[model samples]
Target: MAQNVTRAGKSRTDFRDAIQPFLAPSLREKCATVLAGSVPGLEEIRIRCGRPLMAIGGNGDFFITPQGTISQSPAQAYLPDREDLDRSLQLLGQGSAYALEEQLRSGYITLPGGHRVGLCGKTLVESGRVMRLINISGLNYRLARAIKGLADPITRYIVVGGKPAHTLIVSPPRAGKTTLLRDLVRQFSVGIAELGFPGVKVGLVDERSEVAACYGGVPQMDVGFRTDVLDSCPKAEGILMLIRSMSPQVIATDELGGRKDIEAVEELISAGASLFTTAHGSDPEDLRGRPGLAALMEWKVFERYIFLGRSLGIGTVEKLTDRNLGSLINDKFVLRPRPGSGD
Candidate 1:
């Protein structure tokens, strides 16, 4: 019954009526927190203990609980009823609740709250892949909050033809570029006015689903009416897929680099749709020196590049210099020092 699906051809307006109700008052709070922690001065929250009945999200580098906590190792999740626990264990064995409890004591689980839980004990693997863990440990609960509309400030960068700017956001490790990209996507999907970008089609190539957190194909958060997300697909292939199938006006992806990525963007651009994406780098020299990005950053292909930093995720903007003319327009961060002003 949960909505906010991450399908190729699905539009935001597609499930507006069927999905909103599935958004229990609490789940919405959790989604809000994740966005909040990504940016400063956005929003804040206070959790009341023993309020939410959490579930298991998934098993990643660690076990992620529905509450949003990525666990220390792999944490066990409990059910409300004792019978359920017993039944689960009987059917799933170490994968069951009783077994989970053992793991819980020393186990870690990532909660929907964004906090993580850590666990202890033996590891289970099959053919080099982890099956699960046994013997639980303590659980660490992560809290999630909202940074209300943080991306609202950067809407100007993507406006094209007096419309929303078609932008590509770039940054280095843990620079919060993905978080920024997610928010910007939300703003765009929700529709904007300044550039007549209202209800503009945005195709999200969510290779990891981390951006939208598409749980069981349903987006955990709200994006907008014109958005279509293709979760767990390669960026290059997904771009081409969306371009050919979705008919989106704009294509969006995260952490793009390499010949294929650049080639795909060129394809999208040539097809007349603008692109929004992200990458890793500190400055022009760093970006230009990078193997894959150096070529794309040339400006002839990718028009606008937004660089993100710790303080302001999107700390700077670099215009691609025309390979022929040799100057990137709008390539200034915080506006270059005006003329002859003394500091």
Candidate 2:
């Protein structure tokens, strides 16, 4: 099984183990060898029918050769056959694709260890809605690793005056927004005792099963000691439900967009619950162009706006700003690491 240590210093899981079951036999063997060998910073393992097998790590993307070494040329990589796709579907479905039709329609499946396999294929549409993906062509097994205590540097800003601020984390895709958000959730769940912040009830709306990465109704990740998660639920609906029933001091979710989402955020704020969520963007000005986000900014829904990017590393804090769009901190700020935050 996967083994990961939580931000609260608890053991959880590893991505390679979680991804093993979904890989075809030959590819699985290759990946196992790669993992067993020293492939520093290995992250994603890619499989495509007509293309070479690829592996992505901290250095960059490269093709995986038959000898388990990084291929300098794509031509040196192995091309997975059609049977590999069939086997992958069956394994990912745990025997039958019919069992996971709903998740397939969403273009991805959330595996047990919070690992996600994104699929690409011809879209089957019925009555203007996606039915499923047929003739599957490609799969990207994106690795999910939680860097425990990554959020410690920003805890002081989040927990202000013994209460969590309405925070909105902004970043472009793959900028570690989700990872940062997850760590923040864990910190909120356990609270920073050194900072005089007590653990409060946090309701997490994991719309894509990405936040808490719950498997079979239980979180594979440690969000905190006091966190209630609504997995794979619609953002707007989940937000309302969490507020009505969970009595959370803070409501956290991922990828906020759409009118209903904005309405839900307003409702939660009205109900006296602090909000924590993320959006896709480059910087603060990028948010102004997006309609739903622009509305949130206009309403001043969030008290703090944190901008994350890949400046120094994946989870680098690019900028920190207030609700009024005033700058607060930059990447060079001297942030002391907290206990258990892996200084």
Q: Which candidate wins on TM-score?
A: 2
lDDT of 1 by residue, 1-343 (tens): 0111112222323222222222234333333323322222221221212222232221212322356442334334211233322332232233455544432432333223222233334566669855566432222222222122445445665565655555666666644466567667776776765456666788999875556656556665555567899977889999999999999887888888778988888788887877778877765677677667777756545555566664422233333332232444443442221222111
TM-score of each candidate structure, all chains considered together: 0.54, 0.93
RMSD of 1: 12.1
Candidates in order have lDDT scores of 0.51, 0.80
Across 102-205, the per-residue lDDT of candidate 2 in tens digits comes to: 78888888787677889988998999999999988999887676666777788888876678999999888877788888888888888886688988999999
Query: How much is the lDDT of residue 330 in candidate 1?
Result: 46
Give the lowest summed-lDDT range of ten residues in model 1. 1-10
